[model samples]
Target: MLANMGNEIYRKIEQVKLLPLYTATDLTYLDRLEDILVKNNVRFIEVTFRSDLAIEAIKKLSQSNELIVGAGTVRTQKEAKDAIENGAKFVVSPAVVPEVIEYCIEQDVPVFPGTATPGDIQRAMEYGIKVVKFFPADIYGGLKAINALSGPFYDVKFLPTGGINEENFMEYVQNDHIVAVGGSFIISESLIKKDDGETADKALKSLIDKINLQK
Candidate 1:
């Protein structure tokens, strides 16, 4: 189902892809992005620990109590725990790490670890995970990579992150195997910096609307 996932993965993507960052600006930008995402019907948020005030931000977003939030760029187990502790509903990584992946599974916390090649996909498969993020997606051949993986790994679903954007967004998600996509392009740091909250929000709304458009 092209709904949120596993339909398991999508519950994971919202937490990861929606991980937007601030420009060389203040923390209040999140307020604007929040309004945009909420109005646009973007159901997921990727909250990575890489940001300056991640825990606090996670706490803040949690307060809104809307959208399925998750941690992104999760490299260590400690980060994963912190995100969950701060109210992340799931976790996502830029690449596959057996221990980290298993840690989520062990806690039954749901994870969307990254994969770029068949070997990486196999590693995810070894653990019996159904959904994975295709990272550095553009560099690794973008849709071609997904298309190739689908040949042997039919049951596996992907949330292609990294370079996904408006131009090619529909191109990827419209496919049978691509469950969703992740990227910062839809809601950018630049837009946040300019203090154009409404414009940014409208852009995000348009993107989400485009995704839900009928063929």
Candidate 2:
């Protein structure tokens, strides 16, 4: 039943097609940020554990039914448990951590482990994971790398993050193997730090427009 729940959450992510990576150091503007995301129709967000306030941010944001909150940059079973306890509906990690993956699966939470090579992808597949994160994508050859990896693992879908931005995100999203794109591009850290809701709103609207055009 937990596996089914994980699959359902994955489907929701695919439908939205954008996974905004958020890092919060202060909670002052979290509500405003949530408002911008909701107003733009974005349904999922990955609050990265890059900041000390990430778990707290997840706790606060997960309370809202308007968005599905997830924990990102998670690398341990302890972090996974804490994030989930605090209300994160899913977990994302920079690399494949067996313990973390096992914990998430046992708990039935969707997990996306990072992969940058065939070895990593194969390892994830061995663990029964169908979707994996392509990290530092730009440095690893970007879309070309993902396309190349697709040849051997055709059944696997990728969520390419790192160095992705508005100009190149569409290229990745258009690919058949891409489940969804993950990055800070849509709602950048700079924008958030400034509490610039207007700009963030415009960025998200533009992205939604682009996705609609593709459809």
- Best-fitting candidate, scored by lDDT: 2
Which parts of model 2 are misplaced by more than 4 Å? 1-3, 193-196
Over 4 Å off, model 1: 1-25
Using TM-score as the measure, the top candidate is: 2
Q: Pairing residues by index, what is the TM-score of model 1? A: 0.87
Q: Estimate each model's TM-score.
A: 0.87, 0.96
lDDT of 2 by residue, 1-215 (tens): 44476788788888889999999877877888899889988978899999999999999998877889999999989999999999999999999999999999888888999999999999998878899999989999999999999999999999999999999889988999999999988885579666468878888999999999998
TM-score (C-alpha) between model 2 and the true structure: 0.96
